[model samples]
Target chain A: MTNIKDIAKMAGVSVTTVSRVINNQPYVSAEKKEAVKRAIEECNYRQNINAVHLNKGKTFLIGVAIPFSNHPYFGLLVEGIANAAVNNNYKLVLFQTNYEESREIEALMMLKHKQIDALIICSRICGWDIIDEYVSYGPIVLCEDARGRRVSSTFIDHYKSFSIALEYLHNKGHHKIGYCIGRKTGTNSKQRELAYRDFCMKLNQPLKPNYIFYDCFNFEDGERVVKRLISMSNPPSALLISSDQVAAGISTCCKEHNILIPNKLALMGFDNQPIAKIMNITTLEIPLVEVGRNLFLQAIENNDSSHQEISVKLIERLTV
Target chain B: MTNIKDIAKMAGVSVTTVSRVINNQPYVSAEKKEAVKRAIEECNYRQNINAVHLNKGKTFLIGVAIPFSNHPYFGLLVEGIANAAVNNNYKLVLFQTNYEESREIEALMMLKHKQIDALIICSRICGWDIIDEYVSYGPIVLCEDARGRRVSSTFIDHYKSFSIALEYLHNKGHHKIGYCIGRKTGTNSKQRELAYRDFCMKLNQPLKPNYIFYDCFNFEDGERVVKRLISMSNPPSALLISSDQVAAGISTCCKEHNILIPNKLALMGFDNQPIAKIMNITTLEIPLVEVGRNLFLQAIENNDSSHQEISVKLIERLTV
Candidate 1:
């Protein structure tokens, strides 16, 4: 509750002298500094950290923008980022954007205003132009490929990962393949869409718009996919799910419906989450924690621009 | 990068005049105010938010300390807190304590230094003595029963909830009952321990210390429990698991090992998470999000210390 002014009044010195003493600036007399120190100790005064940050031009706070905080994927990412932050002597300001552009803009504005030293966006809802406008303000790190952009990123080659999964399904004698994703927008999803189109064209099969499922993020969304699948006259024999939570959900629903996995409907999941191993669902493992760590490191690094690519591996399990 | 001094120089005014004009304080001449405004616009200066907070003696940031960011229990609680914070125009400074006392001390220190306006500890590692030391710094809200303490809290009556579950199992004709917990130290866990001890005494059963499980948090921990159960000469017929993730793990392991549920072993889980519902495990529904919302509200409320007790419900399903 004690401010510098209180300390100044108590020490019988000007407020500027108290400020100089607190900041260790070389203007205050030794006697005046000792008096200010005694006054501070007597009152148990704790210097406001904001004032310290104002003098240093660094807040020691990083802004992390994620759509949802409770999702398994983002949870892992945040855990890694938080761990790295702790080691670097920084704290995180979480911006749960919920995939809203306005909320994402709020995070960007915080960077522009110098509230946070840097920002790491796990997934962005804003377009490239909007994100580019804030690049000169501070470091903006992305979890997607921004190799040619002004910002830095730690990304996964979603196109290659999707192609590998589709090819594996194709080799397993499954030409009728479909996929589910969190949303149809975003760079990652668009890359996966391109891979699926190329796979269909290479196999001389017409693309089925109905085969792609959108808005699948959690286990509950799996129920919606199942309902749509059963109602279709020609459902894909195998499906690639973007999240293990969703894949696990579909697997559970299949069991309840007496639909045998890998025989009735093959499933391949992404993220290789713990549920995937427990449910025995084959998945492409993306090391989200490692990606999150790299994102944080890049955010703090004073480099021009950097890009790091993380590779995914396929884990063989019973569901495929 | 243009500071107040630069603006003052450009406006041909003193720094105090520039500060007064920027803060909208009265007594500045109309011509001088217009000159300061034009200078500010010309430079496109952004007022540092930290300076604004320093002047107001308030930061629109609340601190949240959780043991882990990736756990389901804390995840749900954080989601609730985050939603409430977004609605109230506040951001969260996350301190992933990982149950370390030093980490918790850092969070308390932030409060003392006036970095965060208030702190909401979802779970605590420090003792009451240490927490009491920071009570006068700001509003410190807990997620445990802190009725007689100086801080406000929104907590569950762990003793009553544990008793209800034990009574339900007793009525179902179970004698040998064991329980699992994340740890044995916290107030909540101690209450559960008391309830278990009293249950055994009331039923004329011997207290089996070996029956109590410790360090069980995630789904993978179920494998360890099952391994220990199979190795025991006389294992418990029914078990009370504190987390649904662990319960689901035990169920999955049980199916693999050909153990029948409710026949060989009956299980009751807490926190009725999504995994509990998906796996059809009987659980106690603790509205964690609602509890989190209340905790946030209490953290922001400038009232005397208040305590809110959230009740739990029994959700009957197949696993029990």
Candidate 2:
């Protein structure tokens, strides 16, 4: 806890002399340097890392802004980021934003304040303008497409992936298809919505707003979806769930409700999470961990703004 | 990035004078302060947070060392910690130690280096002596029993909880009970093992080493357990799965293999996670988030070393 002043006082030297000695500057005399070293040893003063970071202009800390730390989606992403960070000797400063814009801004502000070397936003809640404003401060890596933007990102083509899922369902003779998503506002969700709209247009099918389930993030949400499905006058024959957790939930609920999957209610899930495999639910595999690793790598390694797109694949399982 | 020396040079003043001005010390003249302000504005030099942290001797950053970030158990614990951290205006520096001693030491080293204000070991891999060595650096809160130790902790009475589970199973006519665990080395796991041993002794049941499952951390591990169970000459009638995720997996696999629950094998899971509810798997509710919140509170709020033991409750459902 000894400050520079304390070290200087203990060593019988000026504060500036102590600073010079600590920094190993040439101006500090040998006798004064030795005195400062002795004082430091006697006081057991461990040099604060913040001061070292201030001098070096690098904290080796990458800020990761996530919505929720406990969710499976973010958990996988963080695992990828954390592993890459450890490999590079960089620690992660987690900002669990809980989808709050203010919390996301706090992460950006940390970048501007030089508390962290860079930031990788796992799930962004802020507007482009707000994010764009802080680009000059430090590297801001995103998990969504940031192409034609100042910042860098490692993103998935949500539109393409959604289309793939839709086309697969369509080929399986499922014309009345509905989908579930975490939220409608996110860029990925918007892209998926667009894909759904396009699919509807191509098939000349009416887009039933009621059929699209929102805020379906966890396993519990699946019960809500199934309850709604059972009550609907004309429920979709097949459903595309954005998260595998939700899909697994629906699968479990279907068994309880005697709703045979792929016959009465076909279920296709995204992310291909472990639950999907356990429940034998068909899903689109989004390499979230790989995307996370790329995001972290871009945050620390990239000097110029860059965008990397990761692809998703469909894993055929029992449900579909 | 314009440093203090650059700002001083721009203001036509010495580095010490600029430092005094930046620190708002009374020694700097008003004219010099005005000059420094103008230089700061012209150069657009943002005040580095590291410098402020250096002066205040506080980072407002707590280190959270967990084995993995993607696992449900740790995920839920981190969620609790993160929420508490946000409430306290603190950020978490995640150290995904992956159960490696070297990785854990890195987190301890960060505490020693004053990079983080405090550290919370969610699942400790390092020995007590190593952790004890860094106690003087800052508060190191643990998620296991650390009573009679220097550090603070919010722990569960694993032995009592495990006994309660065993008693519940025994009363339900499940004398031949086996348990699946993440590992046998952790303190909590050791306590659970002791309880299991004691239960066998009380029942005059022969100890079956092969009945105990180790490294059963995830859902996929359940398949491994089931495969072994099917091949066994006399598989246990009931299984105590430490994680609900693994329990859920066993439930799913059991159904696939035509093994009836309760009649064939009763499953008792720990940590009543969402998966447990979906699968109707009976489990011991650990209240992990509450434990996590208490852990975080202990890390920041407690001045003296403290120990808080959280209790678990049995939530009965179908799988039991």
Candidate 3:
């Protein structure tokens, strides 16, 4: 093996000069650079690319911080990001936080250490203040509608999408309409809550506390919600679910219980996932793939700090 | 501000000596090692950990190469790998190849370049010759049953499991049995086809070429298979689906076409994924999470080029 020592000795320069030349550091004379290059060529040394990348202050690697990897929504986003990374000649290092603070911090630390050129945060438990601290390190692109936080972001207007779902349900002669949520405190959920409340107030429909199901993320959660809803003294006529997966669950459980959809209980889901089309569940189509592509673009540009909004549209299916 | 150059100058030693000291390389004289240490301490130098890792020939990073990121089987496997990585203080660098040879080469290159300590190839398109060439670079762990190639592997006994599935379907009085495949030439699929053929030949049952569906990896593909199957002059009374998601699609499509599961068509799916449970499809449990953990364990061990076969169990559900 031709070590750095060999290169230095062969170049007939101080080890410091050889080190500087090898690392692509400035202040090395043209003569020393030529000598180092000649030595490397003569020795045919296979240098670790990480050494070059560390010196360049960029790795062409993007860090994607997401709470989950297997979830269809996040999976679609990751797939889109993967395509962009391939096209742009970058690699994505995933930080599957699972909503844990410690795991999320690992990604931010990688940014601080210059392990990655940029970061794309899909969702976060940490506050904006915590995220802002790493802004100077490199581009920090958010995959959320955080236009108010002053960073590059690509997201769908959850409030508007939720409003579309609620208003559609309300106009369908459903006075008592309830909804499902993943988390009460998440920005998307908060906006959805606001939209639900505003729609109820505008339509003069009384809001039922029990109708709001919390933490409904998957199909099983939707089934559990439906089981709970049926036992209630008075259940809503229609339900606006947080995600299509949840709606799929409710649909399956409903079939088992012989609860005819739309005829007995109207259901509307969000995200318009492929399953939604298969299940014929009317949904708000959140362009997550577009959000992912835009996030990568912003991170690569590392500038503009402009908020990018991906449009959401309502798809009509038999469930509503 | 204190780079390797300053450390070399301060230590009164070659930059290579300072690098060897920082990288914890052996064979340095006591005097030089002590001098480099004292100089580093005096300067309060904070070396780039990446530089140190590069020199040490270790990065504590494992490259995970999978065809899809969001698919349930791969997602579960990745989640398992992520947990193992976190526990072992290693990071997973994902290469979502999507069945592309070019993308898969990137991970192998990273392994050769010492960017990653090892590679955990979940699935790959590259031939064994290409994969075997990189054996000296680092430990290569496969998610498939490729024991014949002389590498560490964590995989299911697909042949045995498929035989079990076929025999079980036979005992259930299904003579006209068909199956779907992701790729015609995949090891798992080949085993499954062998089982299907061996079972048919032994039982003196006729094999219908039209029943063998190709490229049935996803939900849409499965739905396409079902649509094509029902239109055939003679369709199989039962189907052994390639994956649970595909089975879910068939189940959903069956519901639309006013077909009764188990009675009209017996469906058996693989992977026993969460969607399988929701759809109530009978499946062979591959224990993907267990496979992932075992792969990581073998990768970290970096020895014992033994073939590991994870057992598969048949789970009875309403669909079958």
Q: Among these predicted structures, which one has the highest lDDT?
A: 1
**Candidate with best DockQ:** 2
lDDT of 2 by residue, A116-199 (tens): 999999888878857777899999998988799889999999999999999999999998999999988989899999999999
Worst 10 residues of 3 chain B by lDDT: B46-55
Query: Between candidates 1 and 3, which one is better according to lDDT?
Result: 1
Error of 2 at B78 (Å): 0.5
| Model 1: per-residue Cα lDDT over A25-117, one tens digit each | 686789999999999999977677666676778888999999987899999999889989877878899998889665677688789888899
- Supply candidate 3's per-residue lDDT for B36: 93
Give the per-residue Cα lDDT of candidate 2 at B96: 87
- True-vs-predicted CA distance for residue A281, candidate 2, Å: 1.2
DockQ of each: 0.31, 0.32, 0.23
- Whole-structure CA lDDT of model 3: 0.81
The TM-score each candidate achieves on chain A is 0.86, 0.85, 0.84
Off by over 4 Å in 3: A1-48, A51-55, A148-150, A203-209, B1-57, B204-208, B254-264, B302-306
* Predicted candidate 1 versus true structure: per-residue lDDT over B48-132, tens digit per residue: 6656676778778899999988899999999999999877768899998879776777688789888899999989988875787
TM-score of each model, in listed order: 0.85, 0.83, 0.81
Best by TM-score: 1
Task: Give the range of the ten consecutive residues with the poorest summed lDDT in model 3 chain A.
Answer: A14-23
Q: Write out fnat for all predictions, comma-separated.
A: 0.67, 0.75, 0.49
Q: What ranking of all candidate models by DockQ puts the best one first?
A: 2, 1, 3
